[model samples]
Target: MCSASEGQSRRSPISTFSPGALRRVLRTADGVLVEAVYEPCTAGFEGNSPAAGGTAIVVAHGFTGSVDRPAVRRAARVFAQRAAVVTFSFRGHGRSGGRSTVGDREVLDLAAAVEWARSLGHPGVATVGFSMGGSVALRHAALHRGRTEARTDAVASVSAPARWYYRGTAPMRRLHWVVTRPTGRFVGRYGFRTRIHDRDWDPVPLSPVESVPLIAPTPLLVVHGDRDPYFPLDHPRMLAAAGAAELWLEPGMGHAENAADEPLLARLADWLVDAAARPRPAAPDAPRTA
Candidate 1:
């Protein structure tokens, strides 16, 4: 177990953040303790109180990525400049303990983070996810649009796979090998510091494409790289069509959050902030006019 001081003292995305930011371990519904960092928005932009109107961005990292990874930290810092930020490792990654159910059970981890952000009294919250995290974000928004809890105001998915078991690309095939084979799981546990569950999806949870429409009344943005080696353009296209999501297909982009440039991330931040400001529909079934 990590002491509070160690978590606070740990290196982050440079000195961009103050030391007082909260470090916490949130437990999921099933009892997995998730390690997370929540940084309240600083003064540069505005508003700390919910009535004053500020949005919190809950960022989910890609596969093999953790809250402590440089990419995650950089994204968090950039978003923090404008809004509160919460970054956490999926179970089996980083300080969080558990076996990775790949993407199925990870939604609980994100749900915990979102609930935490809401608990801070930030009425509006947006979730930004990349790759595997992106898929999980979509599913979480669908399954728990927080009907009884605080709902996600907006969602942005970057370089996400629309469907499951897609082995169209070389990288994806290797990933399949890694997830299915015992040797691959062993290597993932030690080599990448990411633990993979050996078993396949029992019932097979909702696919990213299928999860999109369920988030209709909630603002959604799907961003993808044209040059992405993992998933082709078809993935985002499918997701956009089903969910009525706005798709931004970047020409020179590669794959995932790490490859995205600062300019793109900045635009994404603005979109989330704007989405948060917009009023949520009266009902979940209401079609998004915006």
Candidate 2:
């Protein structure tokens, strides 16, 4: 946990730039320091690309994943072909501070990243997340709906669960153990370099299904694989049904970042760009005068 002085000092976002990447240690609302990287669009202004030069795509990685992970970097590179991209390590993962509340408090981390993206002057911002990050994306969009600086223009959740505490699958059961048991946490710290929180959620955060409905007016896409070992097809279906989101049930893909291929990543980038360009629904008319 950050001391009062340290937290106050980091209340504002701070950033630095390398040749092609902007690196930052963003402070979440809860005082956790999250590590993030921003890569400018590489394919600058191709013919008729809706997002041409004014959009930012925030990439949220899965559990045990970080900004430096190969999978996250690959996705960021692909997304940068269309829009400026920001990738961040959720708290407790990589160099970030604070313990993981799993998906509960992670929304604060995503919110800080989105605010940083907007601060960079991008007119539009979108979020694309996988697994644990996917859940954060949905919840953040819903929770921050009225907060202009923190809300996302569009959101895509890949391989996310509809509800929490799901232990139907073997992989999920193992993940629960990793989050619940002290020995499992030890393995996570030593083996995966991920630090798990010791306590359970005080009040369980809103589940993805519940959040989906609140994300309306902001486009939503839910992608899942038929062969996913962690979450079944029913997960995406539930999300799609709840929010009328675009759903893609992949054929042979398995799980999060590892299962996402280049082609799929490209498609997600295109969808985000197009979705950001889409006009929001018009407001209902006032009562007509006689």
RMSD of each: 5.8, 8.4
**What is each predicted model's overall lDDT from 0 to 1?**
0.80, 0.81
For 71-130, candidate 1 gives per-residue lDDT tens digits of: 678788788777888899999888898988778999889988988888887878899999
Name the candidate that leads on lDDT.
2
Q: List TM-scores for all candidates, in order.
A: 0.89, 0.88
TM-score of 1: 0.89
- Candidate 1, superposed: residue stretches over 4 Å from native: 1-16, 45-53, 284-290
Identify the candidate with maximal TM-score.
1
Report the poorest 10 consecutive residues by lDDT, candidate 2.
1-10
lDDT for residue 118 in candidate 2, whole number 0-100: 87
